[model samples]
Target chain A: MATAGTADSGSTVPTGTSSIRRMAPAEMPGSSSTTQSMKKTIGHRGVETTTGETTYKKTTSSALKGAIQLGIAHTVGSLSQKAERDVLMQDFVVVESIFFPSEGSNLTPAHHYSDFRFKTYAPIAFRYFREMFGIRPDDYLYSLCNEPLIELSNPGASGSIFYVSSDDEFIIKTVQHKEAEFLQKLLPGYFMNINQNKRTLLPKFYGLYCVQAGGKNIRIVVMNNLLPRIVPMHLKYDLKGSTYKRRASLKEREKAVPTYKDLDFIQDLPEGLLLEADNFNALCKTIQRDCLLLQSFKIMDYSLLMGIHNLDQASRERERGGAASGDRVVLEGPVTPDQRRPQAQKSLYCTAMESIQGGR
Target chain B: MATAGTADSGSTVPTGTSSIRRMAPAEMPGSSSTTQSMKKTIGHRGVETTTGETTYKKTTSSALKGAIQLGIAHTVGSLSQKAERDVLMQDFVVVESIFFPSEGSNLTPAHHYSDFRFKTYAPIAFRYFREMFGIRPDDYLYSLCNEPLIELSNPGASGSIFYVSSDDEFIIKTVQHKEAEFLQKLLPGYFMNINQNKRTLLPKFYGLYCVQAGGKNIRIVVMNNLLPRIVPMHLKYDLKGSTYKRRASLKEREKAVPTYKDLDFIQDLPEGLLLEADNFNALCKTIQRDCLLLQSFKIMDYSLLMGIHNLDQASRERERGGAASGDRVVLEGPVTPDQRRPQAQKSLYCTAMESIQGGR
Candidate 1:
C-alpha cells in the first residue's frame, strides 16, 4: 500500500527523499505478531517505497522460496508431461494443477493448470510447442530458482513489480489480485488463439501462480523475458503504433539503455526498423496476423517491443580497449544450437529476437 | 476396361483357361498411338489377366515413371513444403500445388491441379499435420520411384492396381479418376480432422500425385502400406462395421493370407481381437473420436483394416526348418538403430504402427 504522502504524489519520488518512518509493532494498528521480525514496514524490501522500486533481496528464506517456486513449476511441467504420449485423450481431459497446504508448511494454496495458466491452449498444443520448439522441462525448472533472481523495478507504476531470472531467460511478473481471475476467464479464447495459429509472436507464458505474501495473495506470471541476456541490445524501442503520449519521460530517457517510444523512434529513425527484405516481409506478415488475432479477442494498447544490437557500436567499443569486452559485446546470432549446449534454453521469444540485425 | 467376355462373369477366371485373345487397335476406338508399344490390351503384366493377378516387371521406363511420379510427389510435397520452417505464417497462408505443361515434355496436355487432381485442403491444417506429425519431404520423395517400384495386384478388381515401393514402405494407390476429385473436395474436412486430433489411427497420407500412365491421367495417393512387407502378418481382416454383403469371395479366401471380413472374424474368433487392457482402451478412445470426425464428414462404408501376426506360429515355422526363413518373420520392431544406417527413412506411419501392439 502507498504511504500517506506518496499516495497523493502524481510522480514517483527518488530514493532517500521520502519521509519513511519505522513504526513499532505496539504502535501499528492491526499488526500481526509475526510482523515483529518484518523490518521497516514503511519502505522495506518487497515493500514498495516512494521511489517506485520494490527490491527483492536474497535472504536465507530464499531456499524456502525456491521450493515454493518449484512446486508451481513442477505443477505446470506435469500439465504437459505426457502430452506427446497421449494427444487424443488430452483433448477432453481437464487436469488441474493444484497445491494444498503441506503438513507443517506455512505456504498457502495455489493452482496452475495447462490451458488456464500455461503456454499453448491444450496439452496437445503444449506438446506441439515442446516437440517443435524444443522447450524441455529442465529449462523451466532450472531458470525458476537458479542462483540469484534479478529484481527489476517498474519505472513509472507504483506497486508494480517483476523479477528476471539470473540468466535473464524468464520473467516472473506480479499481477493484480483480480488479474489472475481475469486471465482464467480468458483461458478459452487464449487457447483457441494458440490452437488456430501455430505461429504467433505473442508472449509464451509458462505458468501462473498465486503466492501468499504478507497475508495477501499475489498473482505471478512466468514468461520468457522479451530482452534476452545472451545477446545484449544497444538500443530498444516499444512502438505502440501511435504518436500521442508515447514519448518516454526525461528521467526514463536519462537511463543508460532506455526504451524509446513510437514518437522517439519515428523522430530518430524515420525509415522504420530496417530488416532484410525477406525478414521484413515475414515479420510484417506475422505482425499482421497476430494483430488480427488480438483484434478478434478485442485486445488493445499492446506495443511492439523492438531491441536493436548495433554491431558497429560493439566494434567501436572493442577498439577503445574496453574492459570485459568479451562479455559485453559478444555478437552472436539468436539461434543457439541447443544440441551442443544442454543448458541452452529454447523459447518462442528467440524467434521474435531473431529479427534483430547484427551488422546493419 | 474389362473385356466384354470377361465383363459378364461375376467371378475372376483362372489365367491359363481364358481365351487370352488380344483385341486389335483397329477394333478399339480413340486408343492413343502410345498404345502401340504397350502390348496385350486384354491382359499383361501390370494389366490384369482374367485371373485378376498382374505381375510387376521392372522396365527401363522406370526412370520416366519416376519423373512423372515426382511431378505429383513434388506437387504434394510443395503443399507442405513451408510447413516445417514457417509454422507461424502458414496458419493464414493458402498455397496451391499445381503441375502444368512444360515445353518439350513427352507427357501431353498437363492439367493436374485442384480438387479434380491434387491434395491440399486448408494449407494451415496440412501445415499443422506436417508440423505436429513430423511429416517430412524425404518421406514422399524417396517412397515414389525410389527403387524398382513393386507392382501389387488388386484381388477380384480387374483394372484396379497399386504398387508398393521396392522397400515395401509405401503404397502408391491408383485412385479412381473421379475419386481423387472427391477426396480433393473433402480435403478441408480431412485436414481439420487431422489438425483437431493428432492421435487418429487412420491411414497417414504423405502425398497425392497424378501421373500420365497408359495414355491417361492416373491419380495416385501415397499412403503408408497398412500391410507393410517388413513385418508380415499371418492373418489379416478387412472389417467393415456392417454385416450385409461383407463376406470375402471364395477366390479371395483361397489366398495364402486372405483378408477376412467382419462375419469371418466373428465366426472364427468370437472372443474378438485380444489386446492389453490399456491398448484396447486407448485404441477404442481413438477409434471413437476418429469415427465422430468421419461421421461429421458424412463419410460411410469405411473399414478398419486389421493385421495380426501370431508370434507362436512363427516359432512353430522356425522349428519346422522352413527354407528362406531369414526373409520372413522379422519379429523385431521396425525402429532399427538408424545411426548404423544413415539412409533409414523416418515417417509418421511408423509411429502409427508403434501403437499397434502395446502388449498381447
Candidate 2:
C-alpha cells in the first residue's frame, strides 16, 4: 500500500550518521558485546496529513531474507490427508513475513516497517476462516479470499497479486499496468537505495516484468526463487492428537521452531546473510505483526481477491453450447519448455501451496 | 494434489443413515431441523473414477486435516514482530478431496461400513491468516497455483453447485449462460448433484451471465447472495500473553457472547464457542508446532512485488519509451453489473480496518 501518510517507506531516506538505537540494554545479535553497539532505530518526523492523521501505518512484516525458506518446496515431502496409507509428494505454496527495524537510517539497524502512514496501506497480514467467513452468509464470495493477500495502500504505486487453480493455475492480480513498467526500472533503483538495508533485509534484485491489464500494463516483479514447504504436523512436528506417538515425540522442541524445508518452500538463504543487521529483525517483526498477530478472514474484504476471482468466475465460457460437443476451457499462456529449467515455476507452486496449508 | 494410492481408512460407515447438514446450523431465524440437518458429512463412496491412483491422492489431504493448524501464524502474532498491529487476510485455492454421502437410501451408515469409500471431489478451503501477508521472497506472480475453473462442472444439473469460499458467507456458485436457459434447464440438475452433500461446502448459486474470451461466449456461475464474513475470534478468549491472574480477572471472557446482527456465523455458533470447539487447547497444540518454522526469503519470490514498485519509480511514458506498453492485459468480465445486493463499500472497509487491530 502506498500513500503520502505512508511515509514513502518503499524508499528510505538516509540520515547518514547519527545513531538511533537507545543506550538502554539492547540485544544485538552476534556481537554479544557488553557495550551497546551503534544500533539503528527509525526516526520518524511524524508528518501530519490532510485528514489530520499522521498517515504512516507502522505494522511490520517479515523481511524477504527468511521467506525463501518458508515458501520453498518441502524437502521431506507432503503427507496424504486420507486414511489411506500411501505417502505422497505435496505441491503447495507457503508465505511468511518479517520486518525491518523501525526508525532507522543507513546508519541505523532496521529500515522497513509494515505499518505505513497511508490510508491506502493496509497491514499485510491474515487470519481465521469458517468461524468468520460463515458468520455472514450473504457476504460470502463478496470477496474472493478465505486467506488475505497483502492489502495495498496505493494500488497505483504498490500492490500485491493472486493466482487460482481450477485445472491450470490462473494468475489474477488487480495490480495496474504502469506499476509493471516501474518495476522494470525501479527494482535495481531500490536495490541500490539502502545498500546495507537491502543486503540485510533481502537479496539483491534479479528479474522483473510488466504485465498488461485493462488496455495497460502492470508490474509483476520476479526476484530470487522462493521454495515451498509444508508443516505436516501429522507426519512431522507436534503430531497433534494422532495415534502416532513416535512422530509427535520426534518433534517436541522442533515444534517451537518451524521446519522450513519442504516441497512447498526451500531453505536457500540470501548469500552472506546477517544474523543481526539493521533491517533484519524489523522485517521479522513485520512478519510477526502483519502476517501473524492481527490477521482475520473477513467476508466483505475481498475487494482485492474477488476483484480477480469474480472476473474468472464471471468470464467462464459455457460448457457444451459452443456449436461443438467437446469444449474445454482452454487458456494459452507462454509456456516454458521442459528441456529448460522449470525451477522457478515449481518453487512458486510450492510456496503458494504451503501457504494455503498454513500461512494465511 | 490430484492422484495417489494408499490403504483404506477402515473407518466404519456411519450408523442410522443420517443425511449431511447443509443449512447454516439453524441460525437463519426460520430454518427447521430438517433443513439444518441436510447432508452433513461425505462418507466417501469411491467416486466413479476408473482410476485408483487419483482416488488415493484426494483422500490423503482429507485425513491430514486433523493433524495441525498453521500455528506459526499465531506464534508470530504473539512475537514482538513489527507488523503486529493490523488486520491481515490471505487467500488459498487448494486442491482438496471431498466426499458426497448418499441420501437416506434404506441403508444405514452402519450398513455401508463407510464402504470406507469417499467420493473424491476437488473443492477449495481457506485457512485463517493472522494480521498480515508474510514475505516469501521466492514466490512469483504467475507461478504457484495450478487448477482450472470450469464454467459448469455439470451441464445438465441444476443446483449442482460447489462452495468456493472458506467463510461460505458471501458467495455461492452455480453455472450461468443465458439467465432464462440456466434457470429453466441447468439449476436443478446442478443442485441435485451438490444437494447430495447437503453441507454448506459448495457455493450456492445466485444469477447468470456470459463473458467473451478468445471470442467464444463463456457462461459464468452466479452464486447466491452471500458475503464472506470475517472468521471471528472472540477477543476475550484471545488474550495472548495474559498471566493466570490477568486471565481470570478479565471480564471479557465472562461476558455474554456477542452475536452478529444479520450475520449468522459466530452468533449462530453455540455460545462458549472456544470451549465448545475446544480451541483454547487446540491453540496450545498449534502454537507448539509452528514457531520459528520459516527459512529465509529468496529473490525470485519478491519479483512481482518489487517489479511493480520499480515500475512506479519511473514515469509510465518513459518506461514505454513513448510507445504503447507491451504487457497489455485485458480482462473481459461480467460486462453486466453483478445483480446482487448493493453494499455500502465503506461500511465494509471500516469493519475490515478495525478487524485488523482486534484480531490475533
State every prediction's TM-score relative to the real structure.
0.48, 0.17
Q: For candidate 2, what's the TM-score of chain A, rounded to 2 decimals?
A: 0.20
Model 2, residue A71: distance off in Å is 34
Q: Across residues B1-360, which tens digit of lDDT does each residue of candidate 2 receive?
A: 000001001111100000111111221223212212232112211122333211111232122111101111222222324321321111121222222122323321222212222210111111111111111211100011111122222211122223232322222232223332323232222222222221211223322323222223323232321122221212212111223332222232233332121122223433623332443443333222111110011101000000011123224534565233334321111112223322322221122112212223
lDDT of 1: 0.47
- lDDT tens digits, residue span A67-108, model 2: 211111111011111121111001011222222234533322
**Per-model DockQ against the true two-chain complex:** 0.03, 0.04
Give the true-structure RMSD of model 2.
32.2
Worst 10 residues of 1 chain A by lDDT: A1-10
Best by lDDT: 1
Best by TM-score: 1
Badly placed stretches (over 4 Å) of model 1 are A1-68, A76-83, A87-97, A100-132, A155-159, A177-199, A212-216, A321-329, A332-340, A343-360, B1-199, B203-263, B266-303, B307-360
In terms of lDDT, the poorest run of 10 residues in model 2 chain A is: A300-309
lDDT of 1 by residue, A1-360 (tens): 000001101112111101111111122233222233343232113432334333322121342244346555556556545533323322323334344444322333343311122122234534444444445666666666545666665423333345677766666654454454545444433454455544455655555565443334445556666556555566767666788898878887897777677789898888766666866666666667566755554555456666676666755666675343444545444445446335434443353535222111
